[model samples]
Target: MRELTESETRVLFEKLSKYIGRNITDLIDRPDEPFCFRLQKDRVYYVSEKLAKLASNVSRDNLLSLGVCMGKFTKSGKFNLHITALDILAQYALWLKPSGEMSYLYGNHVLKAHIQKMSEDCPQHQGVIICSANDQPMGFAVSARAAVECKTLEPTAIVGYHQADLGEYLRGEETLA
Candidate 1:
């Protein structure tokens, strides 16, 4: 990812703050230095550290990736948000029903009946921070339909897939660390 210009960084932060309902320009732009990085023309990554003094460009394969705390990148350049980084802006979260939570936590898409709650604030098909009925954030999901139509969704209809989940921590991999 390449370092963004000051103007470019401010623009991005403004857009994100609107979506999450807060002016969080300072959240991604540290007081001491910058925290935003351009992953391409349309996508960007936000880390917790100030790396501009060390380097300007950091790609996915670079070892410097260790400094990346979290990020929001575009998907097909349609919208800017990566499903995994949902926790940072989780205030406008979607709370799923128990059944729906189970389906999603296991890597399956969420169904209509599984949706216990969600904010009417979200637009249709937008990436959302998802949580279980208990308020535990499961991960991210693309809204299958708008709030008005969510109730009418078929039980078998898939809402959205998990962009990230805690279950993966115990998957086939074997590690003691």
Candidate 2:
């Protein structure tokens, strides 16, 4: 594990804080000369160094940076959330029913009927993270309607579209050409 310097940690925290919409650096981490987090077997979750790198880029470029590995959840059950640090911080989340989970994971948009719940994170048409009922972050999505208006939407209405669903591994079925 690489121990980050004070400035490095501060820079990382600031960048993430802005994207996540929360000042929660200390909640998940501690400030030290060399700040680092070791994922313990007993721990349920932890963010990866890749997140910091991505955040740095977003911070430097002032854009929405998409990362491949944001964070992970341990089956050990130390925590209940299996989401990327970025999504967790963004505050907008959508919980989908089992049927929706299948469709979303298979690269389809979630309809209102398939949705189990939605978080009051961002305004309508804003970006939101879609998760399974288990609280596992599945992918990024854009809210089809405002937070308050989402509930009034029809069951078959489009709730959000899957932008990233960690389907790269499942996409490796191509044979050498």
Candidate 3:
């Protein structure tokens, strides 16, 4: 594991900013403690400065991973978010109806019929956290329509595009482990 290069940080921040917006500052400069991002293999880990310092003592060959596995960099350089980062990215969310939870867990995109509520100011084509009506985050998605547009759309209209979900824990257990 090593520090991210300047270009790598830029790419990762750009992607994260899309989902979390200004909240990126909260991740980097926490009130409790200092934290940082580290690169291990192709994965980026959100680790604390203290923990990272301790982890650095271990040999690279034996250190499999560090703190939270935020995401990974694709071979082409685009950053792909892992489901593990959902907690940190749970600021803006779209609440789904109880009946629609199963479909999203099955990796299906959220339809207009599934939406129970959402941030009123939510705009179209923006990243949003998909949550259960009870306020549990299910995963990440891109809004298919603006908050106002959903009110006029048919039940079958797409509301959010699925990105990553809890189902991936079962589907990609090997990689996650």
Candidate achieving the largest lDDT: 3
Model 1 residue runs over 4 Å out of place are 1-3, 6-68, 72-84, 172-177
Per-candidate count of clashing residue pairs (backbone under 3 Å): 3, 2, 0
Instruction: Kindly report which residue stretches of model 3 are placed more than 4 angstroms away from their true locations once superposed.
Output: 171-177
TM-score of each: 0.59, 0.53, 0.91
Question: Residue 55 CA error for candidate 2 (Å)?
Answer: 18
Per-residue accuracy of model 1 over 1-177 as CA lDDT, tens digit each: 466667666666655654464637555566776555544444565564555434445444563443433454355323445444556666667888777776777877777777787776566766667887787777766677777777677778766555656566655358736
Q: Model 3, 42-139: lDDT tens per residue? A: 99999999999999899888999999999999999999998888877776678899999999999999999999988887888888999899988899
- Model 2, residue 9: what's the lDDT? 48
Quick one: how many clashes does candidate 3 have?
0
- Deviating ranges (above 4 Å) for candidate 2: 1-19, 23-92, 175-177
Evaluation by TM-score, superior candidate among 1 and 2:
1
Give the alpha carbon lDDT tens digit for every residue of 1-177 in model 2: 223445544544554443354645554554532223323222222344555444443333353333323342235422222234535443446778887788887888879888887666556666567778887777777677776777677778887765667553376458424
Comparing 1 and 2 on lDDT, the stronger one: 1
User: What is every candidate's alpha-carbon RMSD to the true fold?
Assistant: 6.0, 11.6, 2.0
